[model samples]
Target: MSNDLAAQHRPALFHRAWTVAVIACLTIVAAAAFAAMPGVLVDPLHTEYGWSRASIGAAASVNMTVYGLIAPFAAALMDRFGLRRIAMTALVTIVVGAGLTTVMTDVWQLTLYWGLLIGAGTGSLSMTFAATVANRWFVRRRGLVIGALTGSSAFGQLVFLPALAWIVDHQGWRPALVTLALTAGTMIVLIALLLRDHPADLGQRPYGATAFVERPKADQGAARRTLRVLYGSVRDRRFWLLAGTFAVCGATTNGIMWTHFVPAAQDAGMAMTAAASLVSMIGVFALVGTVLSGWLTDRFDPRPLLVGYYAGRALLLAALPALLGPDSGAVIVSWVVLFGLLDVATVPPTILLCRRVFGADGAIVFGWVNAVHQVGAGAMAVFGGFTRDMTGGYGPVWLLAAALCAVAAVAVYGLTPTAARTGDPAKA
Candidate 1:
């Protein structure tokens, strides 16, 4: 990552790496569009199919789980095959999965299409894809790229949600889905045209690299490699602390906010479009926070930064109930700004920790950690739904997340890379 002659010879104004970042951003946005769809579709599916909130939420739970769980494997697969191939495959799967949702009658079909297929497709991209891209393409500004990729999640919401909500409002959920499928289909063409597996393919060294990085030949069986890393890393307390805090991150953000906020706002008498707009605004601000977090991660210890992020999130979640209710205004708008900044800000730091502790296996280890992230999201998704069904409000869910995030802040407060201390990543 040190300055080299390869860095000096870089394009003055335009870098191919930026092109790759743009493509990666678009890909994440497309996948996130599908991920965000569940929130809008939840009530409609419940109304039309007479499915309980818990049942529909269960499907969402499965989607989040698949999304997280597939990440490490996706990382390994991308290593074995290539980013372009895996990316196109994910987009096609997303299109097919979204298309299938149009005709789904049974909740099981929803689970099959939305939960498994779309989840897997989008999951293959998120954090793992970002980590891979940053690792392969750039040496300088690497954290910035990861931050951009993380922030792109918000961009996905900002770009897709309001329009999707409008479509659902004027047309129907099915048409909205058709629109989503087409959007994802377009990204397939984009990725096919732009994505590359590595910088070496383009006859360029990684940006800022003094020497050419030899692309590591991946061992056969991506799943085997993924699991082997997991098995080794799981014993480390730092991994658990990172995983534990990230779990809360998932629950507070994706689980409750992305999956439940719109519906909860609707239940509080806010218009769906209005609620969706606020969510989009959150994404818009998230871009700022996540990007700044990346910049900060590069300059400081990620551990303290994480504690602060979680602590801030805890305070925010605790205040969510009051902010969502009738007569909500300036307070809620202010809330969105803070929430957006906090959303996905945890990503850069968490990935940094994985890199510091796990070293060579950092990308895959991050993937496994992200799997827990989704599982946590999935758990809260279902629990949020069940809480809604039982208590007729999302207050309990908000309080629980607040409490958990508080715990996470405490859990990660003094965490350091024990593996780094021992000079052995496998030593717990």
Candidate 2:
């Protein structure tokens, strides 16, 4: 064939929007598997090693914090290297870190493997990946896409938690870790095959940006502007509001629940598999909530949405302490539905805030916000574990999580309208 004819006949990458959606879903599944993998091992580590709950929880705490700390830098790295390369690298790192966990014999090793390595890997798979999708793929339905991605993370937790619990019971924690590593490695190849940095890289425009004429290539404004965006957003009140709410979000969801839910369920006399299944149910609700949150973000004010979610979460946290025990199944299931529905629902709005506040710098700005979320989660995970150690239960932590959610609700509600300034009024 002639060269022109060959070029015309070549298959277009990202030819359909559904293809992008599928790739996004696959990334979320890979991400969710690793994220939930640690949770499954938490109880097993304690059972086998006779490790104190605090020690085990501390490892997870470190993981949550490191995961958060790495988010901003990870976003920057993705921006520099492109999402495809960074994601592929993260997938490999996660596999290695997870695979090594099977042989851990001490607390410090657990911390290093699960906390530093896996946490960093998960962070790379997090907001950086989310931003890549929102920034590059669909302009018209950015909110919906982000919602689905965030929902997938929650779905990972839901589907994998109980299943992993069964794996631990039948095959031991080693197999569970091995399964996670293999699954994550497979995802790396899929990502490399499917993902591109941006729509333009594939000779297409973002769904919404299509109406505008293309601008000529510019100099290194893209590089220089990252700093400007970072600096400007750091000074904004709305940024702090989003960050503060997210921090509280970390404190409540990951800081308290992901680190302790299985043990907490045990305290209430539920079996490990049963407890994990309950947590998985929460993931189901989160999937619905996050997707709805995304759809809502496109149609309404994100501030009100944030307010509602946080407030609802506060109520659930407060009720969590009173709801404990063997008879708590109904209560637990309700909490899962309510909490899950509101769980990742906060993310899309927060992303929206990032875009509105920082304009071209939304990706990196959101990265910083995600970092705050992680740090908040880390701080709480550490303290909550210590609290449980002192108190012999997670009751106090549950109450505290509720209070934090209340604070977050108020903080979100207090955000100035000017803070959410979408460039186009119609879009907002």
Candidate 3:
């Protein structure tokens, strides 16, 4: 497998950068296979091992926490080692982690393999990876490239989950684990054979550049750089606002919905396959929502967009408890469609705000914000589990998440809408 892209002078009709973007999309899609697993796994493991949902949720918490925390460092690591090496490493790690889960007998193995290893692996390839690929490969249509990459996860979920749900329902949980690993393994081959560290690596400039620019030097101290960025960023009031709101975003979305939605539905007597299919529709609508949000972000003051997204999310979450049941009724279908629209839509606006407010360090700063987002997600993941065990239902959890989103809405409302867009970005 050669990570060697040839040095070519001008592209004839298409640029090689699009190839890299395509590869990036493939990788994100494959990673979503693993992302789809955790929530789906919760009940099946409970049925197979009699493990408490809280116990499984604890492992999920660790995974989200590690994934979030590892992200900023992973960006630095990508700089230090180059994108191709780091991506290859992450893919291999995922392959091993998802694969090894099949042999696990105890919860600790779940923690090590699924929680820690998969988290670390997937974190390294977060939305930051999409941004990096977009910014480095194409000077023109960068947002379009990023939006496509972000939307790729939805495609993966839509493409993978029905089949995955069928496997878990009919074949058992172990085979599903095998399936996720094989999906990631396929990415390993694609990345190794095709991915390059940078446009410069192939003696080319970024797409749409008029002149060739030398590849930037790699960072030597990845961890220190991430922390330094964090330390400097904490002083800004807007940074706190962004981070806090994003944390809530994490809590409501991946923490509770992604981790518990299927089981919560299943607990209400819905079939696992039906519940999983409903969740997959989330991916379908998320694609439409995210792309539209990106287009909206370009024209609107992102603060208002954030406010609308959070407010809508809060409303949907508040009504979530009454929606799930055995029948795939119109009410539940409506909820899934509406909720899915708001799911990843926060991203484009939040990203624009980060770049507008933080300037050159925006990506790194956003990485830290995303870390807090993951922490919020991790906490809520475990909290949902404990809430379920203690109360025998997830009703309170929904209301609480609703309240948090309301707060997020309020906080985002306080942001200076026009300032981040037009004013000089702060040095931080």
On lDDT, the candidate that comes out on top is: 1
Q: Each candidate: what lDDT?
A: 0.87, 0.77, 0.82
> Candidate 1 — worst ten consecutive residues by lDDT sum?
419-428
Give every collision pair in model 2. Answer: 158-280, 286-340
TM-score of 2: 0.90
Model 1: which residue pairs collide? none
Runs in model 1 deviating more than 4 A are 1-13, 417-428
Q: Candidate 2: give its CA RMSD in angstroms.
A: 5.2
lDDT of 3 by residue, 79-145 (tens): 7888888888998999989878888999999999999999999888877777678767876566556
Residue 308 shift from truth in candidate 3, angstroms: 1.0
lDDT of 2 by residue, 1-428 (tens): 69887665454454555476678677767776766755667667778999977788778878887887677667666666777888888888888888778778889998999889999888877865776676666776789888988888878756788878998999998988787788888888888888877666766666555343242343345445556666777777778877888999887877777767877888889888888888888888888999899999999988899989999989988888777678775767877788888888899988887777666557677877877887887787777768877988788888888888988888787675553343533242
What are the per-residue Cα lDDT tens digits for candidate 1 across 1-428?
54675456554466688899989988898888777887898888888989998999999999999999999999999999999999999988888888888888899999999999999999988889999999889877888899999899767855578888999889989998888788888889888888888888888778766677777786688888889899998988888888888988999988989999999999999999999989999989999999999999888878888889999999999998887865698899999999899988999999878887887688899998999998999999999999999989999999999999899989987576445433634221
Model 3's TM-score against the true structure: 0.92
Pitting candidate 1 against candidate 2, the one with the higher lDDT is 1
User: TM-score ranking from best to worst?
Assistant: 1, 3, 2
lDDT of 1 at 220: 83
Lowest lDDT block of 10, candidate 3: 1-10
